[model samples]
Target: MNFSFLSPVANAVLSHNELLSMQALGRKLRIHSVEEGIPDLTGVSVALIGVLENRNSVDYIGEEYDLNEVRKAFYALYPGSWNVTIADLGDIEKGESVEDTYFALKTTVSILIEKKIIPIIIGGSQDLTYPIYRAYDNVMPMVNIVNVDAKFDLGDSAKPIKNNSFIGKIILDEPYNLFNYAAIGYQTYFNSQEEIDLMERLYFEAYRLGEVSNDITIVEPVMRDANIVSVDLGVLKASEVSLKQRLSPNGLDGKEICAVSRYAGISNKVSAFGIFDYKPSYDDEMTEMLLAQMIWYFIEGFNYRVKDDDFVTGNNHQKYITLAESHELVFYKSIKTGRWWIEIPFLANVNNKLKKHTLLPCTHKDYLDACNNQIPDRWYKAFQKNSVY
Candidate 1:
């Protein structure tokens, strides 16, 4: 609980919060302030932490940024009927060295995870995800990350890590804790053919921007199995964001991005969530309001989470067996939620990441595909990865 690296929320935001209605989210938060120091985290289910480190951004020009506007927009909103307690632990100022900032973030996130509290990180650059990933080293034997971005971000591992390529470092670095990585809303033109091939060869998942926009529900099962979820603001289309924050002309709109965030929050297995690569503008109310609503939807989704993964009791789920070619696919449907899961058979002899039979989240469509002798792409890739591991 050594959060000495964190600075208090800006006084300007506090002044703004004081004038808001009593039902505003700012009024309900356990805020860390100069007067009160860090808030007591007791009964806190979610902690908000902001990072001011953007040196690793590919377009870095020594510019500084703050989340004060985003906080103001967030605080002015009314909270849902959420039962979860939220705390704003404030921002981590840019350290003398980028590594110093990374160390502070890794330590803070690790401490929060140990207490079973989810951290909703707002960061200056997406590369900060590297430290968040590292924070999971001792907490879990294996980790699955879902990155909602327009690029693969598998930059050259041989070079210094940048926001666009930190995934390369994550894949090549030590501990080898990453079990699965999925990219949602990735644009083909933004990535090289080699990166695309690498994703397929490694059995990693990638969904095209058009594909996700066409059907947002496809993200649910992927998010359902993820341990950490990271979103890059660059995924928003040019028209949806401010001039400074725009990255692509073709990207997710406001409604789609919020849906994605809600999916991340609803995932029972997701422990850490972050939205990165924010650039503040003079009149950035549109982007700030959108980001605030995204956070709101995420919190709203978290409040409705139900544990449907427990298959110990046969009465809770209905089991179905289907044959696809020579493969026998076992499916489970939660009686309570109607959600589907496919079983990945255990191979006792292989030295694999999964030591026991595991359930992979799937859709009702995947079940129908199995009945039609068509194997789901998700099941095939997961099975392939498991076999190779």
Candidate 2:
């Protein structure tokens, strides 16, 4: 478990931690400090790493920043009744080249996932997600990403990867591990019509900002089915964040964004989680506090996770079959957690990507829609993608 790429947490934050209450989160964390180096990770469930590379941002102007404010705000909070152990693994300093930074991030995230430790990344730009996604190349057969963002970020893959266009690289790059990508809280106005049509043509999922803000629970099933969850702070409404960090006036509020993070945390399949595009400011207290709370909710949800995916037990779930149009919709409801999943039948031929029958997480509304002879959009897209791949 060599973490040579990591730089220790600043001494100032460590000094500040000593003045806090003994019950504060700062006292509870296994921190990487200048004196002790990286902390022992034994029995640690979650590791936090900050990336200080923003050179790839489309609007880069050679600015430098740090995550100390976020750390200080997070550390001062009191932890909930949680049994999970967390370690702050410090930050990955900007490398000589953006590619070098990406390599560092990819290696770090890969190592964390190999040890079954979820890495909660706080980054300068969302493009860091590309390296994180690449980290899963040999770890999983297929990957699903859920981005809590305002834009589709499907920039031209033919061009150099930037924060706004990294997804294009993910889709066109080697190994081709990306199975499904979903954008939650996307504002149509922020994305071009071509990008919206591209999302449809590729069978990827995109939920509008208004739709998600009206009902945040709609994101649970999407998050449940995801392997990587990347969040853009720009998804927050302008009033909810600092002036420098604000992007849109009509975006997710603090409560809604925090709820989304919790949903991502509660997902059994989600292994990597990241929050990106944080812009430091003189009056960043509000943004820092909100970011801290968002991380707290994620940990809180992680603590409450339940393993209810085993449908073979038969006794733990109830199966229902309904005929909608020409499709036979199979639904499974977990008795333990009351969660629902819709089965995606495996296509007989044509090089199936899933290789076997798979279950797609769905909401109760999907089941009711099937009963009324309507196909769930999620099921339809998944079925179409599975058939094609």
Candidate 1 local lDDT, 55-165, one digit each (tens): 999989988689999999999999988999999999999999999999999999999999999999999899999999999999988999999999999988899999999
Any idea how many clashes model 1 has? Answer: 0
Pull out the clashing pairs in model 1: none
Against the true structure, candidate 2 has what lDDT?
Answer: 0.93
Question: Candidate 2 on 1-389: residue-level lDDT in tens?
Answer: 77999999999899999999999999999999999988999999999999999998977887878999999999999999999999999999999998999999999999999999999999999999999999999898899999999999998989999999999999999999999999999999999999999999999999999899788899999999999999999899999988898788899999999899999999998999999999877568999999999999899889999999987678999999999998999999999999999999887786756874389999999999999999999999999998789
Task: Please give the CA lDDT of all the candidate structures.
Answer: 0.93, 0.93
- lDDT (0-100) at residue 207 of candidate 2? 97
| CA deviation > 4 Å runs, candidate 1 | none
- Report the Cα lDDT for residue 167, model 1: 94
